[model samples]
Target: MSNAASAQTTKTPGPGTYRASCHCGALRIEADFDPSAGTTRCNCTICTKTGWWGTIVRPGAFRLVSGEEVLGGFSRTGAGYSHFCKTCGIRVYGHGDIPELGGEFYSINLNCLDGVDLTGVPVDYLDGLHDTWEQLAAAPHVDPVTAAKRLSQTS
Candidate 1:
């Protein structure tokens, strides 16, 4: 496991496996645990349209259980990759490397998570529209690396 994975093991939903998927289950990822805190909402053009709500996780802690062939994705230069279920058109997850974050990270969509009710999870709203990293970094509900990524976005 990676440092991020080791870090994840110490966090919430404590050391257990949790499952998530797209609308039709055509895409699935098994996470070590559910994020019960510091998740976020992005207001960028793409995120705004898809309503993609997520929490950051290390690559080792997120396992793609299935549906690799049925998944589609979109990405832009200097931006993280957004993946979805090709059949149902449900945006499932996203990931990318953040140099400031130390390495690769997965953005797991909370809406795709099964058996997890994240209603009360404290959410940090990010200003992705204008690339507001300074403001995002100041938000109490998210990690510094995520705030860094928001700053790195290309328009």
Candidate 2:
């Protein structure tokens, strides 16, 4: 292959767009992301109940394609806005800017994504239910021992 051809082949692909929806398909959302960018799982009450965390993206990266009218918002202690589908009661996404907890970011539900392969994608589990939940909720930071143990038990 020519040098130019090889260079082009080696270039990383731009963040690809993926579509997600509520359990009842009442709300559809589109997100552009590099799956290689990694994802997370939080153990906080709401997140634990929902089974998603660290899967958030920038607000600019997400778009509501339909069913905006069916979406509802919920927040606690003025932390963030948790959006859900009114018809199906599925938590779709969340966003907020809680000054008490530094700002907020768009939290997307990975389960909502259609056909993405998450194997070997590096999942970070956080203790969002504990007193130090806030301190361990960030992404790219996983408790090595805990994550390993959890994955081992599950696998």
Candidate 3:
């Protein structure tokens, strides 16, 4: 197993083995993660439109097993990269800076998860849509300006 796989062994759902596919199933991905670990829901425009339930994890924790050739990306003016299946248009995952986004870590779309039980995980919402950049920057442990700038660049 990879390090990402090993990290999951320490948590509940006993390190879930999850698979995510687009609406048409043309694009598929498999990941091993702990769904019980809490996720985030952002109030940003894109997130609201897509109804994203997000979880944060290191890049190593995720792997694209197949259909990479069919994947597509969407980025907003001030948001992280949103990846989806070009064939089915399913919003799969997102990568963004935390703290400034009212999170302590990066964000991932929980809907991408396949086998983890998310019923017990806590969720916190961030007012990304209306909050000022300065307020967002004031998050306890993150630099809002930097995050904002990064988000802008990606979008």
What is candidate 1's lDDT per residue for 1-155, written digit by digit as tens? 33223222222343366677787776888776556546788778878888788888888888998899998988864658988999999988898998876679888887777655443456777787878743353243344564677679954
Per lDDT, what order, best first? 1, 2, 3
Question: Comparing 1 and 2 by TM-score, which wins?
Answer: 1
**Where is model 2 poorest over a 10-residue stretch in terms of lDDT?**
2-11
Q: Relative to the true structure, how large is the alpha-carbon lDDT of every model?
A: 0.71, 0.67, 0.60
Q: How much lDDT does candidate 2 score? A: 0.67
Task: Tally clashes: model 1.
Answer: 0
**lDDT tens digits, residue span 1-155, model 2:** 33223221112323677777787777888877765576667676778777564466677888998889998988865667888899998887888775554465677786676545444455666665674544453344344565788899999
Best by lDDT, which number? 1
Candidate 1: misplaced stretches above 4 Å?
1-15, 134-155
Q: By TM-score, rank the candidates, best first.
A: 1, 2, 3
Of the two candidates 2 and 3, the one with more favorable TM-score, higher being better, is 2
Per-model TM-score versus the true fold:
0.73, 0.69, 0.63
Question: Relative to the unseen true structure, what is the C-alpha lDDT of residue 117 in candidate 1, on a scale of 0 to 100?
Answer: 40
Which residue segments of model 2 deviate by more than 4 Å?
A: 1-14, 98-104, 134-155
